[model samples]
Target: MQNSTRKRQKEELNYLRDKVQSLEKELETKRHQLMASKGEDKENKAVRVQLRGSRARAMRWQRIAKHQLVEKQRAEMQNLQLKESLMDQIKLARSLQKLLKKNASKKVEGTEAAQLQARLEFGNYCSAASEDSLYESLLRDMDAVYAEVDTVCARHPVMQNMEEGSDVSSLLEGETDALSLEATNSKVVPFGMEETCAAVWRCLSKDHVKLADGTYHSVASSPDCIRAKAITTLRVNTTTARMQMRFAMKKYVEPGRVVITLESASESEGPRDLLHGLKMMQRAWVVIRPVPFEPEDNEFDGDLPSEETIIQLCMRLTPSVSATVLDIPGQRAGAITELLLAAVHRNLGWLFQTVENILMEHDFGATLL
Candidate 1:
């Protein structure tokens, strides 16, 4: 029994050793799995860190884009305000010019009227002169007056149709016949003739009669015939009277005309104001564009600015200069002022075109990008 029990114990010890070996194998497998899981966890943490960095970069870019948009909007608003201010200044200038024109008209009226009266007096003197030498001198003076009148009339818009070359002869001939007939039929009664004798003569003269084509006709000088014959023909009245008189006095008479001269600080001032105003408007347009690009800096942006904008800006500037002139007290009157203003405006238009071409080229490149 002792030998059997020892054999059984030995078997039990072998089984225990086997169990321990199996348990060691399981523990080794479980250890390897845990280490692999820890390695995977470490790799996951690295990938998450990379993702977070990428998201931060995206957020930064979005912020930059928003900031640029805000800046562009602010610039556009400022440009609009500047444009409105310029328009207001232009309006005020126009009002000043109107007031000046009214005042100038009133001041010049008396001077123009006095000049007309003096011309009339000179014409009377020429008419009264009887001597040939006096007549020749008067004729020369009259010619000068007529020349002045012609110049004044040329400046007038309404009387433009009454130019020097129009045919006055046709107008005069149309009224000549009536005047001649009147002269022929009118009898000059002796100034001292008694009223009783004149009445008897008229009655006796009226009784005369005549025959024509088998019909009895009045041969006596009837009142109707006398009256009809006494009236002057149109042709005679026009040619021998009014036209002849006009032709005779034309050399010594003044024609109706007036001269205009610009006088004011606005007119006398240089084109600097116009140039400045134009530049301001151009800059304003640039700022308001979707992309603010300076063509002057880089000649490749193809933004073509409208020519009408430049032209309108120049027109606005012109009246402003005129207004400045009106504001100036005791300004001289001369055509030079108007000529200068026109010259400046023309120069500015040329400049605008040149600048526009340059800006267009610049804006085109920027827009393409």
Candidate 2:
């Protein structure tokens, strides 16, 4: 009986061992599954991080694009505003000219009637239409007109007499030499900056001269003395095609000042565009200096010396619009230069007369007429 009891106990122990083994295997399987789940979670986290990074980059680029677009639009709007203001100024100036002409026959200066007329004129000019169709028409026909002028000049020997007697080139060379000498002297006189500027302005502003072409000319002197400035403008072909040209001048009546310059350029809508559409042309201006002046009899105003001035006259031709596009097709450069020079010569007499009248009023002791 004892042997049978012992055998039964052994059998029970074996069954218990098998049960423990099965539990160990089940734990191992669970451990493997947990490890695999942890790996998948890590991969998902990494993918989320990559998506976040891409979204951030896209947003950054979008912001940069938006900023550039806003800046471009702002610049374009500013340009439009500037153009509008310029148009308004031009209209007002034209009206003022007309009013002055109407009152030319009577004594209007410093009078109540003159002041009233000015007020009326200002109002009219301010209300004038901004459309520049009249000006545009003139610009369109510049080429034809230029050609006709050239033909007429060739036919008439107007400059022929001057060419035969004293050629322009020799005269220009001599003047250039004199100007160089005047520029070097240091112990020179100084013109009262304020007085000189005022005088120049008055000379330009008060005169009205009618030209042969039926266009009127007027010079307006700037009131600002520190910046002595004057503008001489010509109005022509108003009925057919309104056109204008301005010669702007700046003067500083101080010693040791050299190198005065004057510039003229073709307005893009006018002669510039007429020459070539793909490329526009421009004109350059020459420098004009005041003829140097010195007081007679070795006079000195205390520490200040008398004023000195130098005068120079030159004409220039260059591309108006494009620096590189200077070639005028079908016309040699020489021929074009000659044509322009002749055009200027034709109007030279009128210019001299205008300057003479202004100088006589100021008693500058010089005359161009």
* TM-score against native, each model: 0.18, 0.28
Candidate 1 Cα deviation (angstroms), residue 144: 26
State in Å the error of residue 219, model 2.
8.0
Model 1, 283-309: lDDT tens digits are 000000011223563466566632211
| Candidate 1: C-alpha RMSD after superposition | 49.7
Per-model CA lDDT versus the true structure: 0.27, 0.32
Cα error, residue 208 of model 1, in Å, equals 89
Instruction: Please report the TM-score between candidate 2 and the true structure.
Output: 0.28
